[model samples]
Target chain A: MHKKLFIPGPVDVKEDVLQKMATAMIGHRTKDASKLQRDISEKMMKLFYTENQVLLSTSSGSGLMEAAVRSCTNKRAAVFAVGAFGKRWYDMAIANNVPADLFEVEWGTPTLPEQVEEVLKTGKYDVVTVTHNETSTGIMNPVGEIGEVVKKYPEVIFCVDTVSSAAGAKIEVDKWGIDVCITSTQKALALPPGLAICTISQKAYEAAKKVENRGYYLDLVKLYDYIQKKDHQYPSTPSLSHMFALDYQLDKILAEGLDNRFKRHEEMANYVREWANKHFEVLPEEKYASNTLTNIKNTKDISVKELNERLAMRGYTISNGYGKLKDKTFRIAHMGETTLPEIKELLSNIEDILGL
Target chain B: MHKKLFIPGPVDVKEDVLQKMATAMIGHRTKDASKLQRDISEKMMKLFYTENQVLLSTSSGSGLMEAAVRSCTNKRAAVFAVGAFGKRWYDMAIANNVPADLFEVEWGTPTLPEQVEEVLKTGKYDVVTVTHNETSTGIMNPVGEIGEVVKKYPEVIFCVDTVSSAAGAKIEVDKWGIDVCITSTQKALALPPGLAICTISQKAYEAAKKVENRGYYLDLVKLYDYIQKKDHQYPSTPSLSHMFALDYQLDKILAEGLDNRFKRHEEMANYVREWANKHFEVLPEEKYASNTLTNIKNTKDISVKELNERLAMRGYTISNGYGKLKDKTFRIAHMGETTLPEIKELLSNIEDILGL
Candidate 1:
C-alpha cells in the first residue's frame, strides 16, 4: 500500500519531483553538470536569503552539520541544545575532538537568546551551534533573536541546523548573521533523502581553513575551494540524480514564491496545531512550537504503536514521538508539499480512528 | 539526445534501473526500510563473495574511503598508488592529519605483490590502502596477489577500493583477506551515482574502535553500531530512493548469475581490448588491463575532443582520458548492464567517426 507520510522527514515527494530522479545520468565533471549545480546553488541562495556560497553534499543533513562544527571551530564551541537533534551537534563536536560545551534546556523548552548571550559573554568559545527547528521536540528556537545576540561576538561562528524548517519557515540567513545554515532535501525541501545543502559565509570558510584535522570527505574548506575552482563541481562524484530533481523542485518552489510557500506552511501548521489542541496538548510552548511538525502530548494515553498500525491500515502514517518522548507524545509533520486539505483529511481520519 | 555513456562511472543506467530510482519515499526508521537494507546487504555480500558485514553510505565511494583511513589507521598508513584514485587515498590521509606514506608505481603499471610485501615488512604502518582497479590508468592491480602478501602481516589492516570494478569483475573479498572493500553504485552496479557500499571485516571494526577523532558523519564504528542495534538502519537518514532501486537491481544482477555476469564483463573487456590493439595501442600493460573499462593510447594522434563531439552527435559519449593523461588517451567503459551488441554498436560508431 502507498501510505501517505505525515512523519517528520522523507515526507511524501510529489510525483513530478520523484520523476526527476529518473533523469538520465550525466558526467559529474562535465559542463552540463556544472550548469545543473550552478542553477541549484543560485536557486538555493534565493530560498535561504543569503549571499553566502551554497554548497551541496551527497549525504544527509548531519553530514553538513558535522562539517560545520568540525571545520569552522578552531577554538572551543558552545552548543545549545533543545532536543535530540541539538544534542547531536554537541556529539559531533566531541567525536571530532573539537572542544565544546553543551548548554541544554528541558526538551520541550526553547533555547533562549539570554542563554546564548550569557554563553558568548564567557569568551571561552569561538563557535556556537544552534538548532533552528528541532524535529524531535517540535520547538523552533528564536534564531532571529539569537542571531542578534551572536552578532555581538564577532569572533564566534554561528551555525544553525534548519533541516526541518528551512523552506517551511522564513530564515533570513544574511540578516540573521548565520555563518553556516544547513538543511537536507528530505524535509521542507520535499525531495528525496540523498543530498544535503548549505550556505557558508566567507567568515566560516576562512575559519575552516585554519582548523586542523577537519577530515577530507566533509571538509568545508576543500568543498568550497573545489566548487570555486571547478565551476560548482564537487571533488567527488555527486548524486546527479538528486541534483536533477533538486533543480526541478527548486524551480517549482521559486515559481510558488518564497513568501507564499512560507505562508502556506504556516497555515498548515496552524490548522494542525488547532486540531491537536482540541484533542491533545502541544508538546512545546505554543509561542515556540514548530511550524513544520507538531509534537503533541498523549493526554488521552492512547497506544501510539496501535494507533500507528491502524493509521497504516488506513494508508496514512504519523511519527510516534522520538527518543525519550516515545509513547508519551506523537508528531504530525506539516512541512514540504503538504496541503491544507491533506492535513484536514489526515486529521479527520485520525479523529475517526481515535473517536476524538 | 539520449546518449549512451561509456565513461568510467555515471555510466549508462538502464531504463529499468533508472525507473527504480523513482520509487516512492518511505520512512528510514520504518520496518520496510530495515527489510530493504537487510536485503541489499545480503545480496551485496553474495556479489562481493564475502561473509563480512556490508555497510552503506549516502555519499560517493570517497566517503567510505575517507572513513576507512580516518577510522582504522591508529598508527600510520602506507598508501600504495597505482593511479589517480590511489593518490586520493594518500590525500585523504593527509587532510585528516593521519600519518601516512605514499608508495607510487608508474601510472600505467600495476601494484605488484613484491611492493606490498616490502612495505608490510617495514612494520611502520598499521593500515594499508590499495586501489584494486585504477580507473585512470585502466590497470587492475594484482589485489589477489597483494592480498596474499598482506596475509603475512596480520597486524596490518588492508583496505581495498573496488569502486569501478566490483560487480563487473571477479572479486572474492573473503578469499583476498580484504579488511575493508569499498565500491559505489554508479559503476558496475548498473545504478545511478549516490550510494556507496562496503563490507568491513571484524578485524577492521576492532581497529576502528581504538581510533580517536574519527569524526561524526563518516564514523565507521558508530555506523556499524547503529546498523547492528537498529537492524541495518543508519544513524543518519539514508537516500532511500537509491535503496529502493538498489534492491531491485541486485535482484536482477543475482538472477543473471554471478558467474555469467563476470563472464559477460570479461568478454566485453576482451572484445574492446582486441579492437583497441587493432587500431590504437592500449594504455595499460595487456596483463593488468581492467575488465570494466579500457584506456586506449592516442597513438594515431587523433583529436579525442573532436572524436567525442562527433560521438555525441551520434548519441554516444566516452571519456577523454583523466588528469595528466587527458587527450593522450581515452577510455571506453563496458561495466554494468552494457552488453555485447551495445559494445559492438559503440565501437562501430567510433570507427566510423574516426575513419579507422
Candidate 2:
C-alpha cells in the first residue's frame, strides 16, 4: 500500500537514500572504497560532535552498545536504566559474563543526574552505560547533567546510546565526556537498517586493551587498530550499500544544517505533544519528553491498534505502545527525515478515524 | 564503465539482486519481518545441505567465523592454515583470548587428514577451524577427509569456513559432521556485500554453554537461544534488505539444482585452469586448486598492475596476488552467478589485452 512509516526505527527511507543503496558493488580493499569509508567516518564524527575516532559496524546499534560495555568495562560496569532499552544493557552485560550492576528508574522516568552521582561516587565501576533516548517510554535522559557527574569518575568510560536521538537532538558528545556514542542508520538518520556507527575515545580504546575475552567481530581495540592500518577498512567486511546511502544522507543532513534538522524534529515533536495533551495525558514528564517521539497515555482508552489499522488503510502507519505500555499508551515518532507537514497529516488521519 | 568483477569477494551482484535491496523497510519485531527471516533461514539450511539451525548476521562472513571460534572453543583450539583466511581464524582466537595454536601448511598446500589425526591424537584441543577454500592461494582444502578424522575425535568441535565455495561446490555440511559452517553472500552466493549465514550443530551449542565472555551481537550461543525463543528473529536487529535478496536468490539457486550448480562451477574452474596452465604456471597444486578461482603465477614477470589496467579499459577487473604474493601472481574468480560464457569473455579479453 506504500504506507509511510512513523515508527521508532526502520522509518520510511527517502527515494534518494534508497537509490544510493542500489549502487554497484565495489572492491572493499580498493582505494575508492577506502576514500568512501574515510569520508563517512569523518562525517559521522562531525555528527557526533567529537574528535574521537569513528568506527562503523554492520550490525544494529545494540551491537556497538554491547561492544562498548564489553570492551571498555575492564573492571566493572554500572548500567542506569529508564526503560526496556536501558535494562537491555545490563542483560547484555550478564549474558556476556561481564560484572555489572543496574540502577533502574520507572519506565516513564528519566535517569537523573543525582542517581548517576550516587553511583559514580562509590568508585565501584570502571564503566557506565546510559541511554540518551528511550523509545519505549518516550523519555530522554538528562545526559548533560549526568555527564557532569560522570566526569568526576575519570577512570570510568561513559557510553551513550543515541540510537533514536543523535541527529534529532543537540548532543555535545565531547563535552559530555562520552567515551563511546552509539547510533544506527534507521532512526533519525533517515535510512534503512543494518548499519551501526560509533565514535570511540582513546579512553575506550585503552580500556579495551585491558579486557580479556573481548571477542572478535566487535573487538573495539582490534577494530581500531585494523582500521588505522588498513586505511579505514574493517577487519570484517561491512555493508557497502548502506555506506553509500549513509554518505548521501549525511550530506543531506549537513545541507539542511544540524541545528535546523534538530529544530524540525522539535517542531514536529511539540506539535504532536500538544495534540496528545489536548486529547490525553502525555506519558512522560514535560521536561523529559523525547524530541524524537512522544508517548501519549490512553486517557480516553482508544484502541491504538484499531487507530493504526485505519491509518495504514489510508497509506500511513504509527506505532502502538511498546512492551508494558501497549494499549495503555501509544507513540508517534517525529524524527528522521519526517517533517512537520507529515506529522500534521498523520495526526489529521487519526482525528478523522476517531471522529474527533 | 561497467566492469565485470572477477575478485574473490564483493563479487559481481546481479541487477535484480541489487534491486531487491531497494525494497521498503519493515519493523524487525513484526510478524511480517519474522516470516521474512524464517523463510531466509529455511532456504539457507537447504543451501548448506543441513537440517541444522541457520543464523544470519549483517556483517561479512568473518563475523560468524569469529562467533564459531569464540563460542565453541571452551577448552583449546587447533587452527589449520593454508593461507590468509585460515590464519584469520587463529587471529580471531588470539583476539578473543581463546587458548589456541595454529598449524600452518605452505601457502599453496592443503591441510591434510594426517595432520588433523596428529592434532586430535594429542587430546589437547576441543575445537578446530579449517578454511574449506583459501581464496588467497586458490586452494580448496580436503575438508571431507579432515571431517572424517574429526569424527573420530568425537569431542572436538569442527568449524569450517566455506565463504568462497559453499554454494559453488558440493558441501554436505551435516554429512561432513561440521559443527559450524559459515559463508557470506558476496562469494559463491552471487549477491552484494554484507550478510553472513551459518549453520550450528547441537554439539557446538553444547560447547558454547561452557564458554564465557562470548560477547553480544555475534555470540552464537545467545543468537541460537534467542532465535529459538523468538521464532527465528535475531536478538538484535538484522539487515532486512539483505534477507530479501538472499531469500530471492536462494530460490533461483534451488531452481538451478545444486548438483548442476557445482558441475557448472567445476567446468568454469577447469576452463580457467587450462587457460592459465597454457600461458603461465598454476600457483596451487592441481589436486588442491579451488573450484571457484584460479591463481596464475606470473612466470613472465610482467606487470600485473599494468595488465589489470589494460583489462579494466576493456571493462573487466581481476585481483592481483594478496600480501606477499602481490605482483608474483594474479587471481581470476569464476564462482557465484558468473556463467561460463562470461568466463570465456573475460579470458578472451585478458588474452587480447596481454597479447598472449
Native-referenced Cα lDDT, model 2 = 0.89
Interface RMSD of each: 0.8, 1.5
Location of the lowest summed lDDT over 10 successive residues in candidate 2 chain B: B231-240
Please report the candidate that would top DockQ against the real structure.
1
lDDT of 2 at B349: 86
Tens digits of per-residue lDDT for model 1, A132-152? 999999999999999999999
Q: Model 2, which residues run further than 4 Å from truth?
A: none
Q: What TM-score number comes out for model 2?
A: 0.96
**Candidate 1 off by > 4 Å:** none
Error of 2 at B194 (Å): 1.4
Q: Per-residue lDDT of B123-194 in model 2, one digit per residue for the tens?
A: 999998999999989999999989999999888999999999989999989889999999999899988778
How many steric overlaps does candidate 2 have? 0
RMSD from true fold, candidate 1: 1.1
**Model 1 Cα shift for residue B146 (angstroms):** 0.9
